[model samples]
Target chain A: MNREIVLSAFDIHRSYGSADASIQVLRGADITIKIGEVVAVTGPSGSGKSTLLHALGLLERPDRGKVLICGENGWALSSRKRAELRNRKIGFVFQFHHLLEEFTLKENVMMPCLIAGESSEEASGKADRLLERVGIIHRASHFPSRVSGGEKQRAAIARAIIMKPDIVLADEPTGNLDADTSAGVEKLIMELAEEGSRSFLLATHSQDLASAVHRRFSLGSGVLREVK
Target chain B: MKQKLLWALARRHVWSDANSTVVRMVSALSIAGVAIGVAALVILQAFMGGFTEAVATGLTAMNPPLHIYLPGGGHMDDFDLGAVQSIASEIPGITRVEGVLEKPAVVSGAPGTVSGAMVRGGNNAGLTIGMDLARELGVTAGDEIRIASTAGVEISGMGRVLVDTIVALAVDSVADFGLEEYNSSLVILPLNTARDIFRAHGELTSLGAFVEKGTDPVEASELLNSALYREYAGGGWPVYMSCIPFLAFHGNLFKALGLERAAMTIVLALITVVALLNLSSALTMIAMEHRRDIGVMRAMGLPPSGVFRISILRGFLLGGSGAVTGLAFSWISIFTINRYFPIKLDGTVYWIDVLPGVFPVTTALVVTLLTILVCLAVSTFPAFSALSRSPSEALRYE
Candidate 1:
């Protein structure tokens, strides 16, 4: 509770239609994540968990609310500035490992650093180190199409964290993997959170995964509530 | 710095998995489209330009290089023939100068073939008729001809004196003047005979200056004009003289041809625009196919501007390479067509026996750059539109 807040969403409201036929997705959802903490957001199908996560990640703007990262208000910043902040301060893992099929796994992992204007040599070096840490260094040269789902997810995670962001957002990171693979990914996520000062905000349906986090929340009917 | 990163990313995307069948096929189709457009434009433009040049050359061959005429819209009789001849002879490029007495006359052949002709002084004594005129008059070499100048009837103090002098001369071979109008109305005689018939002693209609082979007629004409102006400045001039370059006589023809070339270039450029549109479509598909990857990049902190640049770079590669290839193909086609496979044309109709092709460097450069710019513009529209969507919108489902 006394830990430093790395990322926080305050009264986020979002909808997905016109005023006459609107489907309210995230109506005043709020959460604060501290450094090195793992917080999980859980909900049933179509329960606006992804909407809340997207708004916090600055991937989409809320109808009315603010997303703050490291004390900077994302809503107040221009889109360009928000993107820069996202690149420098936030990491993202998706339900499906969205590795660029044209690039090799190493290049995919090195993308964030590359996007941040780092030299290829520097980006590649960091990518190699992260790939080895994630135990996927041997598959670095293989393209995404040639990799397994688990390997692809690992590479995505490496890319997400490559910029050394302050917070990481995972939306069903292990959703497409098998039981053993999901367990492996969950272990990796736990290990990454333990070893660094980075905070983790996870939106998942897996109670087992959510139980391992420091705090958990259930989002339903556009409302967020703390759960034991 | 950001551009370097985006460029690197774009380059990788283009080359990576380039061996894919769809990618290879699209790239090939795009390049071929551009090549065909460029080659077609080059050949068509060259043909137009070459035709004009050939017509100019043919006309130049037929007309005297430098013609000195009275500016006051009358015969050259008022010009001091001796002084004009002297100045013409002093001109450096002028190979020779001829004094001609030209008048409208009625010519009758022994076969009873009569034609209205402009009888002009020539170097030979026997009469020379243009080929068309000979054909019309039914006259050939060795035929006796009589010429009468009706223009000689002057209203003098001796009350309507007809200084009608008829000359009898044998017909020589026909001359080819390249123009049907001139060839059909031409009759040539000795200088003394023309002067006696016209009854204007020591009076010449115009002085024609022939330049050396390979000399530019316009430059020679300019030199002659300046010299003539200097003469007028020095003393009393008999009349105002105008030095006309041979090309001036057919100025309207060249002007019409130039206008046609410009209109043709603009029309044919549509082909290149079509090719660029193909390039635009290719980029659009690529942007669509890469939507997920774009989302990933956006998640990593790439701004929409970065996304925009990446899309534009992809278009540039496709369009730039295609244009270059097209231009290269055009150059080769022009050289081959001009060198070994010249298209034949009828000299009577087109004024040249063969169609000529010339590849102007400036035109090629302009066309290629324009195609590239067009490709960029088309690509930019789709890219900005697609990239304008939020990353969440693009990645919503997956």
Candidate 2:
């Protein structure tokens, strides 16, 4: 049976700098994500993998073409509406863990729920449950500065899926971790994706991570092509 | 919900130790600057307000509220004291009206101790001289002083001659009127004696009307003038009667005081503005330092407006803290000075023996609100500058 499409991007184009000195980053990068699908985009450094993830996640507006999250055209919406869409339906996990250092691990995980207007009690409860699921419940009260790299990454994963988004876009999710920690984070991501029928699109350089995903795509010279 | 979220984020940013040492130091300095500015403004305004009140009380206490007289210094030969008293009684604020004959006189006490004085003769018995006049004449309350009125003149055997109407009267009491002009040259005596000395019987220079406390003297004067005109309509009186409020007597002095108050307020407000500029700089530094955190918030779906609100709230927190601290400081300072260490002044020179500090509540409220408004206004530029960068741009380096 075919799963429902959760996120899709068609012929997306993006560039940097002014017109005279602009360098195009993404050109005709197409992607489609279905529920319960763990997909990886494999590329060399500066190959526009992060750019494609940013466009698909609605974090950046594409210069041309369309990005649809749950059938709503994200770029076509107003900036506020696009933010609402991103908050409600899309989650992001960056390579650096990107947890606010001022907050505890549990508070970091509860941030999205709080942003969605959930009460503190409700958000706290959900955050604890997610922390337990990610196998970092013991470190839930620790600040990001005090946590290990692998534990920080687990908290980041918990935060990304706390809102129960249709898709999670991770750019180099475990790029800074050791081999054992990277494998642990990869196992946690795969387990979470399967448990909740959640889709994940990861931009990574690790062939091991790419091979673990259900599908893989290689981006080169501003173009993305699927590798079976 | 959104406001709560914004407040939470702004509050965390303010209390967070994640900021650089330079940023924290700058923030503390900004708060201190605002506190000093607000304290200075409150204390200065309180003291100035107290001084103005003291001056007003001194002037009003020595003089009657309303002075009813004829135009051009013309005396009323047929001045009916009973009729004017009856009319004044009918007015709500007018407590009493007394006929007065005032004239410049040359007074001498002891040998060659002579000075020019304004002799005001009313119904009060005995001769009352100001402290300064008593000192100058070398006379005590019981010493006799000789006076010759400038208005007293007579036709003698020689054509068109001045009359020497010198009469010696013992000083009843020496008093201080709290003003240099009054204390140095004022003398008070009985109406009958003044009439005999000036040789002008049944004549009154003006009708002095006293009003009840808390009554507006100017409005009462206007009401009295209207009533007097209505009573003396159609040539009932020889000339038109006019009422002058006590404030009108020292209009220029009061106007100058008011202008000084306004100028002082503006000059002090500039200090607060300078402090707010420091606050603006501090907020800008915080925004720059927290760029990456702002990007993380944006990635979590916070809009540009949310970022702006967070910055504004941060400014408000800082400004409000400073304002409150300043107000508390001023209150303590004023209370301590007033209660334990009052600043003494020379009564003869400054009128009052002690300089007073009166806290003005309305002024404090206005200053606090304006400071907060300025904080919000100054934070906007930095907030918008933060907004100019996209989330991806902010997160690019991280």
Candidate 3:
């Protein structure tokens, strides 16, 4: 199994509003993430961090420049193709531990594999292993609304990694947690990247979460610069 | 693998999870509505068809398939009975032919007067009274009636070709018919009497024949035409064929019955449609209430189409279930009543017994198809309702 670069966002810019009222969210933000490297993005408020991650994730198209995932020109692809990549290659985690409230944790984790056309038996097995790995195995049968905050967050992480994707892009992964739970989540995120050799780009405002990663970059005024 | 997952998610969304069990209930209702509507429609159609067939039988029973009329200027002497019989035998389904004389007679009953009745005189064996006219005239079997006509040659003051009119004394009775249209005074006498009353002796006014059982009417008619051409044309009398099949002869009566059933179906089907509306909202609300689940499903990588498919299935299921239940109920009730319950009509009032409910398959099929189509349409809106929110938008809120 030969692994190569997973996702690359070339000098990208995104803007909104017409003419004079225009606002640039990301300008000339570039990042090429390898197959298994974990990259942490940290910035202050309104620093265009989430926007830059969105471009790299292919969820949002940049007004200029191209995005490539697994050597396919993602920017030029159809919306359906983009969705396919999002389903098969990349995983997303947002703040508030956005686990679907109606589904059990097991159903939530098994979703990615199911979308990729894996058999139910196989997907469930994979989901079980992932939940057990993340220490939420006991809560897998419980709905998201029934689970505790920390448990929900852990489930979200398990869901992101269930597909064994090339890149996992997370926005404020531990922003909703207390100090102690935030530390636990950061530990989980670090372990996920190291053991699976999966690339990660986690946007955060937390000091400890950013520092734990191998490399950290800061976003400011529509640009990303390496800080460490 | 992805498609399977997407399909599962779609199924769940449409069929629903615990959080929005009410939506599932709604979908169930939708399926039931469609099923019932469809089944009812089919059953109704069958009954209508059966009724039409039954009525057509009675209408065309005594009425011949074709009537051969002598051209207006022709001589009655040229009618070769033997030649006409041979030609008719060559045509399939022409079982019987009779020479007929039609007369315009004023029927005077003690209770009523019916003027200008186109009295058709044939052998007493084949005459059917217009039952509708009988009810209008209030005459019945064994009743006495008088018929009068004037012939210019009967009195010596006129030329030999003209006779002064005189009253024709005839004992009349009520005509027997398969349908309710006949109760009036009609005189069905022998051909000799018909000829004598009309005063067209040896000058046959019309020649008629009946189609034999177990033969196609059109083929028989064609054969009859060929035979008639060979027989009568050489005899110097041109006889033209009048084609009046059972359907063409009695179309109006059948149409009236059909329109009644159709109106009943339309009015009844609306009830199911209302039920389906509740079903659609229930399904859509289920989708909405389960928004987070949908988001979770999308995160699992199920596509939008999967979402659409599942919801529609749920709606159909609901409608179908209800429809079957309703249809089952209707079937038992109708069957029991039609078989065991005898509704007879008074001879003086209604032409027959109770109006029958016939269950035919073709009508049922058409109705079922329509019901399914309507259910499908209702489901479309609800199926797509939850899908508009993308995985991000859905998950972002949660």
Candidate 4:
């Protein structure tokens, strides 16, 4: 299958606030992921798990680091190029599901494809397939507000992979759901990862979710340590 | 395709029920504000334009489109009426040319009714008195009135003697010139009668020239002046004359109307500015309320420029809707007022019996475009403010 490394972050450093009174979040975080791999990043509260994900996802710039998506240096690219790279190569699923309330589940799933300049008919067709694959095809026409928590998360997952990105960065994807719903979402994630088409980088405090992935890392003191 | 997505995002954000009630209400108020401001400016311009047009029409009704007089307002003695007519006839758009003499006289009807009036002498026979003069003299059409002219006065060896000339004429018509001064004092008579009564034979005050419809009287006057100068110069006569257009003769009244329109435009433009300020506030509020959604969209890989474009598009939608609505409302209001409920005015004061309301299409278009520009300009600050916050910062709490 020629599973090549699709994403790599080297010695990332990020912080908040001014230099005089700053809160350093990610001091020197590093990670690498290959295609068709499911990796988990585990950390306690106040750890830099989400910060690392944000840095790698291109949503936030690191003070000192290199985020390589598909082996391209994202930080060195212009903001526009970086945005295009993010739209085409990386997708995100936040803890809150974060489905746009104004759009139907199908529309939310089609957004990344649309942003990537795909035709609506093509995007719509892909979205429907993804929705059915995620087992939320019945709720595809319902808005985010009208869908259940599990269904919204399923839609978010469907949306993250709509553009066939190299990696999906999930930050506590099931953090806001109940145990059964979380388990169901977790099962859905594992099943999608089993298809071996794209990689998954999941950041969660749940041990069960952390243990279910192919590889696992523990983040503390703004550093990552391989545990699996 | 990206532009289509951005547009879709903007449209959905603006019309989404997910927005807070406060945001929706503020948006509605902003739109209403713009509509009202545009409507006020348009209606005011329409009425002012109509009023100016009405006044100009009234003034031109009583005065000739062009008048030729001797330099320094002197009466012409032994004037060549045929030569002037021939010169005027050669010029295109000069419909007619006629010599006229006017003098002040006292008009009396019945035993005690007497009024001082200016007697205008033209080629037309019979006496046509002004409405106010006829009222003062207790005369109407078919009534006999005596006009006594004091233009023939002499100084004798003993003392100054007044050779008063009185003539009786039947009132032909009572004319309302829509002007207070003209209606209250003018008296029209035949040229022969006026010359005999004023003892000014073979003398004419001025030559009035009427122009064709849609012809610029100023241009016609200039042509006439040039023609007359060339004619007199060719004859080796050093005669000077002045040709005055209707607008130049009544420049003050028209200038006052123009000044009023300018002043009113400035005042009313302030209303539009205030309305746009409200729009700025509303857009700012919307930005604040939608901060989380903006974060989500950004996280979804929407560029900062795309976000800015969406914000601008929202402003265009809101402001464009308001401007169009205001234009339609103004047009309907003007049509209704002009067609069904025309406002009546005092003829003596306003010079027209009914106040006019005209829809000025060009002015409306200008107002709409300016409003949309202001809307976009105001939206810039909020759009920039929205872009100031990082996507992570906005989504931190969520």
Candidate 5:
């Protein structure tokens, strides 16, 4: 295979309300992503950056568009199939990590695999390996409440990759962390993308973070412009 | 595959979290409420069933379903000692017939103004009494007592001679009958004594018959009624008809409790509703608390139906546990009360000595069904809220 595109959104249109009070979130957005390619989306606030990320991640369906992931029509898919796609192919690491407060770090890391219907032993085994790779294995037993911010984000990253998703979607993943923790999480994110054989689509406000990725797309004036 | 995973995740969340525990606890309480209400109903209802059964069986065992006492009327023409016996024998289920004459009499320590006494003529030399009334009134067997009845007493106003002749006889048995109305007044004597002293000539006052076991009164009563009708026509006698079992013993005590039972069941079921409401609130709180986790599960491909199913399962689990606890409690209480302090009506008259409690298997099954229903109904609201929860909204809060 010649590294075919795993995610593509064509002329996507999304509006929040009826015609009179309508607030359009995505206006004819288009993007195609390939395997083993790290893509970063950078933009100022309110540029529909997160909305675009969500639409592409199968978390949000556009009002008008054909969203194809792994060459399957996702925008027209049933809620069941859409959810299946989200679970198996795409992993999300949010700005706040969004780790469940009640679960231990190990359980948190195993969430994606668990949701993918993997057995506890198998999920746990994968989660353990990922936690070790992300350097959060020592704190696997600690609940998210007890873990440090950096450790929590690492666990989130480990969780995102537990099922070995084809693509990782991170939106401002380091926004809530201090510089040192941000650097630590950034290293883990890069390591996950490389060692886990997964592509990353990162959306953030930091120029430094964008510069570190293999490619960057800056969202401005309702469009994604590739920046080499 | 996704549903199983979601359920596993949901179960873990349910098992390992305080909010989840509270949710399930509320459900358990609802189930318990159901179980408690149902068990209480079963226990209480069974008491009635047992009581009515004991009463009916006890009464039926002694004679026919009922005893027909012809107070003033002379002996039934077709109801000869042999005629009554023959009619009864003609029917397959008619077991025994004992023809007897009962008369009221006076046995007084004083003249004229005499205490009450009854002179009954039959083979029955000994009779029992209810314990409570016996203890209340101080009278015993072998004691000289007074009995009086104007069985043939004539009313001066109506010019009617409706009173059966009254006489007294030496009574037997201790003051064991608890009924105040029957205590120390019954005088058992021979038929000749009853007829001669009470002025009952060839006129018989009553005919009693016992029916075979396992024979329903309706069928036997119909059969007996036909035979009596035929006998009346053949002998040219005026025989007014009334079935004893139908008249005297219909287990009206249980019938009387019908409204009370329905009202109690409705009232107690309200407790289950309240518990269900409590469960709903608890489940709602839990659902809200786990919004982000639910979002995660949704993201992990859990269908909305799966979420709803898991909520229902949790409710059922809680309800089942509560039902077990409540059923245990009710069973203990009912079994204990029925076992030790059994209500014993006077056997001689009412046909039973000890009140009985019957636990039917149907009752247990019904309680379980009601528990599940109440719990699951309450759980749906929270599950709906969970289904509508958005991953974006949940993660925003997160």
Candidate 6:
């Protein structure tokens, strides 16, 4: 069967450190996720899982590669234009649930819309709706520190989807959660992928969570292979 | 629009977290430093300005505002006194004009009563000696004094020939003029008496014009020149007359004072620079503490310029509040100093009874702008340092 591709990478290579003492993170990694697809990449520690997620999220430039969002080459865009695209078209969830401590959960969720130049009133309404959908509306006014780890992750997921981006990238989204919280977050991610008509790309070490996605890839030794 | 978002975040960072002791302490100390710097600068400047103004006032009082005379001491013979007085009166800021006939003479009291002193006769009817001069000569009011003028007397081997123009006049009350040299050895007599002693009839020495208070001397001189051209230069009087402002008559004294005032202001402004340095250190601390948050902000699509602007706005807010507080301090202190704590100075030395203060709006405005600019400059290093590394690196770490 055929599906519309929302995000794809072709022959991406990334490395760290100077040439004499370099560590190759991704020799040549390629990925594709269709609309409404929940794809997961399972990898062990030091397997370049987070690096691949960062390159896909446009947080860092892959040394030699092409990243296309909705068939548009991201490398061709200027830095400022790339920032704008990230603000409007891409969302991210980190392992630490990087919610700004200065703002409440609702404000943190509304940040994407604010960055997109939406009015505060409009952003507030959208934030409230997303919080309600994620079952964290009760703690909307509470700060990140005041919430539990599971609740903070839920808020992070809400913030990621508030913009209704074409793709959502999660780098070890459940790495810091317990079994029950991780299971709950996994269910939320799949449900949002269906309801929001967006692709979700998750990198994690949990076999159960990886099995829940429509497709699973194992990353190790600087290569990606289907997990059957 | 992006800038608005960043501005909102900056505002949140500035105002939120009241419970954090570190943030509260840093902000309070920064504001206090700026406030104290501003207050010290303004007060020192006002005191310096007041001292200079007081000295200028005293010097101008001793001499009239405008002294009109010809170059090379050319005597005025049968000049147009009416035209001159009318022209001077027509000028703006001109208050009074007087025709003065000056002559040098020797004045001595009764033998064994007082020694002789150098005298220059003034417009007063009788002989009026300065208080200090009277004390030196051991004379008081109602005393007889003899004055002599040696216009053409020949000195012989036997003795100097007295031209016999000696006139005795009763002493009037002694006056105190603020200058030491003038008060010590100078005496005044009627202008007509001076003319008689000098054997000059119907010849005036110079014209003196006094101006209103708070008038700019340069502007007053220009007005005098305009009046002269309009009135006297047509069928012109006997010779050329130069209108010299009293302050210009002793230019070097006030020039030195002006230079000193500028130097002191520059030195006092260094205090504000120290305050700015304090603010910069506090901002650097803030940046270090918020490193993770800044990384998150950059990941949230805040452009580099947006990040840079947030830091600049932070400095502006901090320095702006401090400058206003400082101006308030200056305003209240000036009022209190002028009202309650009047600083007295030695009248003989400073020529004023109490220290004065003037708060010009320009000084406050210029200082406010300068402080904000300084804060911006000092904050640049730390603000840019927040984004010096890759945002991805910041996210990868903590």
Off by over 4 Å in 6: A1-3, B18-20, B57-63, B69-96, B100-206, B210-216, B219-242, B382-388
lDDT of 3 by residue, A1-228 (tens): 124778887889988789899988788878778877888888887787777776777655679988888888876976567667778888888777767655689988887777677788998999999999999999989988788888899999999988888889988989998889988998999889999888899999998888787778888877788885
If both were scored by TM-score, which would come out higher, candidate 1 or candidate 6? 6
Residue A188 of candidate 2: its Cα lDDT? Answer: 89
Least accurate stretch of 10 residues (summed lDDT) in model 4 chain A? A1-10
Query: What tens-digit string does per-residue lDDT give for candidate 4 at A1-228?
Result: 223989998899988889899988887888889988899998898898888888898888899989899889988998778778888888889899888888899999999888878899999999999999989999988988888999999999998888778999999999999999999999998988778477999999888899889899998887789895
Q: Write the per-residue lDDT of candidate 3 for residues B1-398, one digit (tens) a residue.
A: 44444445545555645445665666666656655665566556655665566566655665566656544534343245455666777665678777766666666554656554556666565333455555555555455555555432454555354443344443444555665543243445566655666676775656666776777766776676666666557677665544334355456866788789779878767866776676667666765666655555554455667667766765565555556665665567567767897445564554444556676655554555555566668778867665665554555443
TM-score of each: 0.77, 0.85, 0.69, 0.87, 0.79, 0.78
Give per-residue CA lDDT, model 2, range B117-199, as digits (tens). 99888877788888888999999989999999877776678877787789888899999876666778889889889888888
List of clashing residue pairs for candidate 2: none
Give the CA lDDT, 0 to 100, for residue B359 in model 1: 89
Docking class of 4: medium
Cα displacement (angstroms), candidate 4, residue B162, comes to: 10
Model 1 C-alpha lDDT per residue in residues B338-372, reported as the tens digit of each score? 88998987555665667878886887888788778
Model 1 chain B lDDT-worst window of ten: B12-21
TM-score winner between candidates 3 and 5: 5
Return the candidate ranking by TM-score, descending. 4, 2, 5, 6, 1, 3
Clash count, one per candidate: 0, 0, 42, 0, 25, 2
Best by TM-score: 4
Q: Cα RMSD (Å) per model? A: 6.8, 4.2, 7.3, 3.7, 5.5, 6.0
Best-to-worst order by DockQ is: 4, 2, 1, 5, 6, 3
Cα lDDT tens digits for candidate 6, B1-398: 45677766766665567225786678778888898888888887778787777677667766677888776777765464566677777777888777776666666775754544555545567777877767766678997777777663767997987678787878887877655556666677776777777777777777778788888777888788777766556766543666878778768967887798788788778878888888998777766666667767666676777777878777877787788899889989988998999898865566566888877578877887889788888778877786575668768654
TM-score, A chain, model 6: 0.97
By TM-score, is 1 or 4 better?
Answer: 4
Instruction: Give per-residue CA lDDT, model 4, range B33-86, as digits (tens).
Output: 899999999999999999888778777887788988877767875456667888
